[model samples]
Target chain A: MSWADTILQGVLLGGLYALFAAGLSLVFGIMRLVNLAHGDLIVLAAYLILVLVSGLGLHPFLAVLIAMPLMFGIGWLLQAYVLNRTLGPDILPPLLVTFGLSVVLQNGLLQAYSADSRRIPSGSLETASVALGPFNVGVMPMLTFASAVAVILILNRVLYGTELGRAFRATSDDAVTAGLMGIRPNRTFAVATGIAMAIVAIAAVFLGTRANFDPTIGPARLIYAFEAVIMGGLGSLWGTLAGGVVLGVAQTIGGAVNPEWQILAGHIAFVLVLLVRPRGFFPRAVD
Target chain B: MHGRTIPWRVETRTKASTVFAVLAAMIIVVGVVAPAYLPRATLQDLFFILTMLVLAQSWNLLAGYAGLVSVGQQAFVGLGAYAMFAGVVLLKLDPLVAILLGGAAAALLAIPAGFFAFRLQGAYFAIGTWVVAEIVRLLIAQWKTLGGGTGTSLPGAATRAMFGTDLVQRLMGVRPAQAVDIICYWLALLLAVATIFTVYRLLRSRHGLALASVRDNQEAARAVGIDARRLKAMVYLTSAALTGLVGALIYVQKARISPDAAFSVIDWTAYVIFIVVIGGIGTIEGPIVGVLIFFALQKLLADFGSLYLLALGLIGIVIMLFAPQGLWGLFASRTGIQLLPVRRLLRGGSLDT
Candidate 1:
């Protein structure tokens, strides 16, 4: 493959990872809470979308739209009711609880869906692609990438240009002090999780369309999102994109060398990045 | 011995010893009797449950006792499985012997890993453990002897031979892998007891006190000159070794070794975490009890399918919201209980109040 092909494939795959990492980065950036269930929620969203598409005969995109608001509500309730209780001086509680939550979600999904994988019903538009220079990219991947960029841009604008963003940053900076300013930290966290879930819903659209999915697949997505977040540094949205791009390129090149090398290459890159920069390549000093 | 200056001391060792003996008695009785009521397959499943209990207890040592919530414990589990397979395939070692080697391999792998992973704090630390798991999984997937991406299965007949019966006879029940399975059950039980005893001992020791102080308040611990990071690193390595051993046991019982199964983050890490939380973190009895409850719940809800998922998920949501200390906390609150002998309790005499 030419350099253009490598970069193009890399950028396209970055979209998938960005989709994977967006919800994770958003939650981490806004509140210092690391939702270990983030990837499972993505899997949950995929399941929800599957139900919507199958039960309602809606287009896959439309299924995503239907799932987004519902997921937002679930996320909101999860944060406000469950996660709020776990947040405190000791980080162990939330971590332990989320670890539990990951279990329940996956098993619950397994119990409901069995281990069988189901994919979102997408039309031929999935394969539809446009040529960018000499490289051809899937329309879905392109859209997924574009959606990632859009999500980040909108998040950045919201963070820097809106009240909730201010609240988000304020809470992130210091929840105690933010309380002094009359920001309801609990509510802010709820809204943050809600918004994060909405993004997750979008990611699920791409995830389901790209590959077959089951309840068991969430942890794998969690791995990718986690790597992207760590690679990009916490709280840097653009860094997530870069992390995704790097991961995508590494995987594609690894696959090019040998199909078996695909997953291995991504992990090697992650380890190398961690060794070279413990906090990540583009860590936020603010965090 | 006379001391110029005496330090404050708390004593409950007397009561702890009694309770420890009682729990041991109860476990032995259950192990001996439960097999009678359980079907052969069910008995085998019970062995698996025991394996998980061991896993959860080991994880509790790292997260509950050491305050390092690792999400990548699956790494050690996978490493152990791979090590056992290597022993079986290349060294042609007996399955039982492979388990000890597996534990050693997991511990050896975890040392350097602990150096990098322990550099992180809180959530970062959790993710760091996960990253290590990913690295391990991916690394194994590349090696040929390990069965790379597709994953290799252990020789079926060889695995069956561990039970002291030929494969056909074992399956047909002309010879029960009965002794073998029971022995495995016994081994897992013994290990669980030993792991709990070790952790409890650590908690009661002077070093245990320092670790407890670190878990409770790091700044105060630091001001007193405790090296929190090094202590945590040690705990992480120890937990890794214990979990690795359990993973080897699980593989031996299953008669299979596959990357997807051996390295399953969900199987070892997430569920063990759930067990720790739902039972109680920082308590030896919690994970054991939690695994029992969870396994029971799974059995009860096995028929519900996805709806069961919704129920389990809802249960998790409720646990996080209302019972952060988990089921064990409720029991402790009612009984002033400290099971598994980690902490000592004093019984009240008549008219004490």
Candidate 2:
């Protein structure tokens, strides 16, 4: 039963990782731009939620709801104004700009909010647990896992079943052709980034409730998110979830054997996955 | 293919080279004499600048020349530092000797690291290198002999017995710490000079031209008989070796070692990247100028804390967007002058006459 519980916990923890990777995957899929600042943006969203919770007296979930559009605007403006120019030919500009953005974001956050670690106060949900047949699951974790699934389902639906989704795919396939077809690639990229940021907000809520966060924690989270994205194969949404599960399970099992090995185990899993399948488990046909 | 070709004389050196030599000699003389009149803090600051110069030059070689932008250089820095610590503590070697051993170890690690990183392309390669560094950091944290995650200082015996301390003390007539600073300063000067000279020479060589062609177009370079992979691997290994040496020297001067400090992205990789990018990456003179500006900025804005770092990032982004070639590029283009010129000019003297 304990072993089953561990595996269950691992899977649930993977939901959080999937949340982190989803935004990164979305941006990368549409534009082929890997945002080095993705993790820092996650941290930034979490801080925004914190601000709402403390300053405005809102519940964490409600605060995330309010922060969603704001983050979207930030993301949209960032892409339209800053990142779009960096695209085409040389990969260094986008990478370097994003790298600079990461540094700026991290230090900016540090200046605004001191180095103290913070966590979202989760009223009764913090301790509340549901008794299953073999294991007890925390309510917050369950909600987080459910939210992750819903986010993926909704993203897939939007991606596959809508006009905007068509634009995204068209732009991603060939920006020139998409532009010829009257689809604005730059605008599409901005919208895609806006959507990614909205998802990032959702992930931030779960991330804030799950653990303590500080400005510096973003890069580590980014590493895990990147591992998930890469291991699941680039551009495949569901693969990211699976990659998250792989990482989570590896980490928990490593922790079970020895506590210090937890983080190490996740990294080892990422490396092993890369070694066996360099393109990842579900590489996009286009790439 | 040519209808009629005449012999030409190619001149590699210019008046600029002579001017550069004179300036370098003067700087060396100033550096050698400054410690006598300058304070300890200034020497320490110069040491920091010199070490950063070495790292920046190494990174420029990888990113600027070979088109491999690694975000995980701190991995080598940390590895080199730990190797030095291990040598000094375990093998009972002098600190200076251990620094060399540390560099060798880092070079060795670069083989596998390069193998893994080369499999990925573009941005994936960057992230892959970072992951490798993180893994190395995590593994290093578990080693109890190196004081685990908390880190350890160089033993008293090691510091006391460090090579050249007695000579520095005898010459400078200073305290032990100050004497150590003088020795480290001189070593850093030598390392910086060697890094610049080696990079310049490598860039002027045939292999360097091959590397440039490879970077411009790998498929085309391969068609022209260049082994892109092998050349990239060589550059990566060489950069790692130099970075490791700088890292070991850095830790030795600090007299302490910790995984976090050793493997710090901000301190080692990010700062170096900022320096290289802003200074004029790919040019031999860029890092030298960049390091000076960076040192100056640090001296000016050190009190602003996080804001200083924020400004650096903002400025770097602005530079990348506006002047992709960097400050040195701007200056060079505007003046049409190069301090360390690598180009060979062919003059048809007899044919012209």
Best by lDDT: 2
Worst 10 residues of 1 chain A by lDDT: A92-101
Chain B TM-score, all predictions listed: 0.86, 0.95
User: In model 2, how large is the Cα lDDT of residue A14?
Assistant: 90
Model 2 pairs in collision:
none
Candidate number with greatest TM-score: 2
Reference-based TM-score of each model? 0.88, 0.96
B242-322 per-residue lDDT for model 1 (tens digits): 988888887777666677777877677766777777787777778877988888887898787656545655665577568
| DockQ value of candidate 2 | 0.80
* Deviation from native of the Cα of residue A30 in model 1, angstroms: 1.8
Q: DockQ of all candidates, in order?
A: 0.47, 0.80
Model 2 residue A229 lDDT score: 92
Interface RMSD of 1: 2.9
Model 1 per-residue lDDT at B257: 68
